[model samples]
Target: MELQKTMQRSLRSEIQKRLKENGYTLSKLSELSGIGTGHLSEMLNSSPSRAITVNQLDAMATAFGHAPGWLYELYPEECLSEGKISRPRLVPYLVRCAEIGRKDCIKAVVSNLLENPKNISILFSVAEQLFQSGKQKESVFFYELVIDNEKDSYSDQFVMSQYRLFRAVQGTNTEENWKAVIRFDSYWKRLPENVQLDALLQLANVCFMMYRWKDVEKYADELRNLATIVYENELLRRTSPKANDLLKTERHLVVYYGQGFLLKAAALKKQRLYEEAKQYIQGYADLGWFEILDETGQQEVEKFRVWAKINSYTLDMMLGNYEILPECITFLEDHPGEIFPALVTIMECANKYGFCIDEVLERFSEYTSYTEDDLNGLSASRHFRFRYQKAIYELQRERFNIGINETLRSLALADKMNHYQDFKQCVSLFEEHRHHASNSQIIAYNKIIEGGTQTNESSVTLVSSSFGIL
Candidate 1:
């Protein structure tokens, strides 16, 4: 009889909790369950006064996973003892809250569970939720707590490494923050080489964000060497029936190799080794390994190609290779809507070599008229550059007011799109042009000053396309 009453209280509490989690008010739930709202209210408020019908209780139980008899046992067990019986049910509710972006709710439930020594899985769930919400610091804290509590769990190492990696990344913009990443890499390297490779890639990204070009190059070289060694070892082994399955599992190795090559190219670009950058980027493009991934990878590879071309054009301009500028322009013309990097390259060439901005603007205008809609679908960075160039063209043609308005509008769009660097550039350009006498003069000056002032802003948060690789 005592057990029966305990079960009733547990069921009632669990039902109420589920309904709240689902955002259903008592009245709403009553309507959905086809029960009188007053009766539902009375039952919930009664505190085990009257026994609920098995059929009605079963309906609620079926939806929330509580037994009918459990709803009747309330008074004697003042507290619902949460043990193995409740932990499983609580996990799904916590997960549901997280899925709906309810971070505070997740925190509340997770905190409650954490206090009860048996709820270890709650820590992992909370860590995952925090990470997804971009709350890396909190994620790491919870993950560390879990690791300290469950030292023998096999997943502890991987979870700890992940937490450390995110912690290091969250502070990457500052030199002091990079130390955490370095520590993470060190810990990861102490693991097996395969595990080390994953950490190495993340470390490379940290180096890139911190603008530690030499470290980026160093890591890329190490990764390449490691990949080559692994490939050779695999080649020397005799094939078994399971070899095909193992080989299939290793397909990610190609992605790792491709990323290493891509990073090496970016490092070269940063060092002003334009030709080297182009060669490496082109090699990755030719390998077509990027195609093995999703659409995001393909877009990223294309963006890298644009970066290579832009740097190549800059190098050519520096070397007085006037012939290359037109070729670059022609290549951009052939690839109509990929205008941002191409525009940057064109501006670099024109600003350095004294190419007529008016002519370039005219060409761009003509190009946009032909492919505006198509180009709109390019990455956000590309879209901003395209609009910026169009605004420049309008300004040059004596459309000062219209040009300012259009440029400001583009800056807002870029901001919404989170193209931080591009948005900053657009803002700077607008501020410069806003003071000009007529819209026509602004347009002329806009062309001449295409590469006007190099703002040291970092790139935007990784777009979905670029994020897949990370």
Candidate 2:
């Protein structure tokens, strides 16, 4: 009954009547709501009345023994003044609406606001505020709305919305991640420099995961050049003959500088440019001398130092320098996090150079097992790579049963991870060695193929075309 009354009346009228019915004076209501008496009177009785904020409305709701957002359906009135959206009132109200799961109210308010196309900026601002406040999932509604309504593709807000959306949707699925990259690719150069730095870094990382080595090198080089220019400019800015306002980036400046080199080196290694990759590795190997080392920056420098060490050894191992094998194993034993990737490299080297690593494989049999929790961060991709490489290694050694089993296991993970490229490679590898497969291995292969067929049938575009099908 009370909800119906609230539905029928404006928020101000509803609050006014509630105070009267409860026998609460202006002073009493103000005391209950923590609103100033003068402001309360202006809100309830003035000729043109002041707009109420969402917080004040929520306070009044609490004062009147009602739930939070009890008056939300009527609260949209406070977000307008003579039919112009009251930004000061609307912004918080929209954010609060999202917080309280008032999607209908959000939709009503947003639909009215968007009648004027210029209000896309207003929506974008609200989205940015929400994103900054750690309301990422909620911000997607506004970002998507901005993307849908935005007319200028190159506009900062549009590009920013695209970038934010891109970041939000990234996940373990490689095909979906690639689609996101493709959607956001053109907007990379158009983003504000701070956003561009993070975007380029993300682009390079995603490309690395997809085995897009050239693209990784391209974006990583761009990230390096941009970070250097920005870092140098920041230095000049700080030493200027005026105020000392610092430049802002999503991460510490050194991270971009270091990772730019790190990712580029990683890509170079993937592409078999070992010596060239080593030079880039040397680029970020020592960042203790970088300017402006805060605690976080210092920590990043330490990380890069560690990465430089691991990757330097990684390069030597990749070059088939078998002398350092035991040393690398000890290093990996010391840093368990590096084990899966190191194993991938080890298996690859073993396959390429025709070396026996049966003992080495047994040494880390725990990680060699495909448990999700065991390989937490680099879980899906690295495991997939390791299994693929192990399959190749075993097959080259004529160990058909173990090789085909590894191939089937990798195919299952690739399908689940939506890693289409690896999935195809696994399929091709399995077919090439099908004649040696035992009956049960053949049955397991058939089941995996059937599951993949169902997945491809259900979401053909996502499963196939997004990764270019071939």
Candidate 3:
């Protein structure tokens, strides 16, 4: 196969031409670019010129009154050393190209680098370096390259790249989030144990939001078991003292352990298994007794303690224990972040047991009016659920105007989120009470449905445009 050709003029040649044209000596260029004259001389004039670093190249460009990547088209020549890909030159160049939005250069360099299959590892490392430096969006280009070119599915680079791609691809769009989760599901177990714990927890959370209760339970169980194993290994490590090579997780060990129980219980609660969920909730309730509680671990324990109380009250409410209602409200008032989900529970129960929450609804009226920013925050899923439940609660109370409006808002949000279950519920609830809706409400509902259709079409166009990039 023919190696993809690079620019005819070398990076050194371009720099030399630029210097002569501007009548700037090497010493003057070095002073302006913050590079030493001796080093710049070696880079520009050696028999086999020393490779120019990305920072130095950018510096030269700036000193020459050009943009950061002005000489990038000529850089592919620098990435080669006697017809072979040179890692030292290629890696930093590709990263800088991504930083400067030079996809044309990235495509050209990556195509050439892939001709020899062994060069795949260099791309994987480039992806990792970019990711670790918080250039997540830019790193996706190399990660996708790794995924497409990697032939060994079980290789560590292949698995790690898949995991990174999964994490990097998630955004506010629920449909996209779901697709990412599904694509990443099978690979979670193949990741290093530390990452696997975090991945499982994330999977459960996403599934929970999408109302995929069974999948949530599945991931939660895996999380619980793995967290236990990791915790025990940590215990043995503490005792053994063999240089203290700890398995570093993204969060505290206690967090993964607690969340394992917390998620399992939450999923069960969603499935209406109140009694079964209570057992799992108790598992995380008193993690204060857990060994090796660092400050963060202690804080996670307190969080679980709070979650235990919240979930206990939620189960009682679901079981029609309305007598505990006042205390539950008091507890929620103390934890503002928990208020939205608590409200969702309150509304769901009211609709279930034929109770009136007119007072409860009035008390938390401020939270009902969600803003656009809420869609990107921690409570996005809860906010969506709250809208749906509030619509049901209002419709049941015979408040036609408010109910229809809330229904329309929930329907639009669900469609935007690609939350099919909630979307269907909104449609069914509206239809069931269609007789009560005004002419304007009916028209509004029709438009929301029409808008959803258009959004899906636009999404298709976007995915088509994005195909080769991934």
Per-candidate TM-scores read: 0.55, 0.77, 0.85
Estimate the lDDT of model 3. Answer: 0.79
Best by TM-score: 3
TM-score, ranked from best to worst: 3, 2, 1
For model 2, what is the C-alpha lDDT against the true structure? 0.80
How many residue pairs in model 3 have overlapping backbones? 0
Point out where model 3 deviates above 4 Å. Answer: 1-8, 16-42, 45-50, 63-65, 172-182, 243-245, 354-373, 376-378, 432-444, 452-470
- Mind giving the per-residue lDDT tens digits that candidate 3 earns over 187-237? 888899999998887787767667789998898899999999998988888
lDDT tens string, model 2, 1-470? 99986467877777878988999999999999999999988988898887788899888999999988888998877767686777887888888888778999899888888899988888998898888886766788899999999999888899899998877656556777789899999888998887789899888777777889999989989999999998888888878789475567778888899888988888888788999999998898899988877999998887777778778876887787877888878877887766766777777878777888899999888877765434321356677888889899889889999999999989987886677778899999999999999999999999988884223312211111001000
Mark the regions of model 1 whose C-alpha exceeds 4 Å error after superposition.
Answer: 1-82, 85-88, 101-122, 125-210, 233-241, 244-252, 275-285, 288-319, 329-338, 357-470
Candidates' C-alpha lDDT: 0.55, 0.80, 0.79
* Candidate with more favorable, higher lDDT: 2 or 3: 2
Best by lDDT: 2
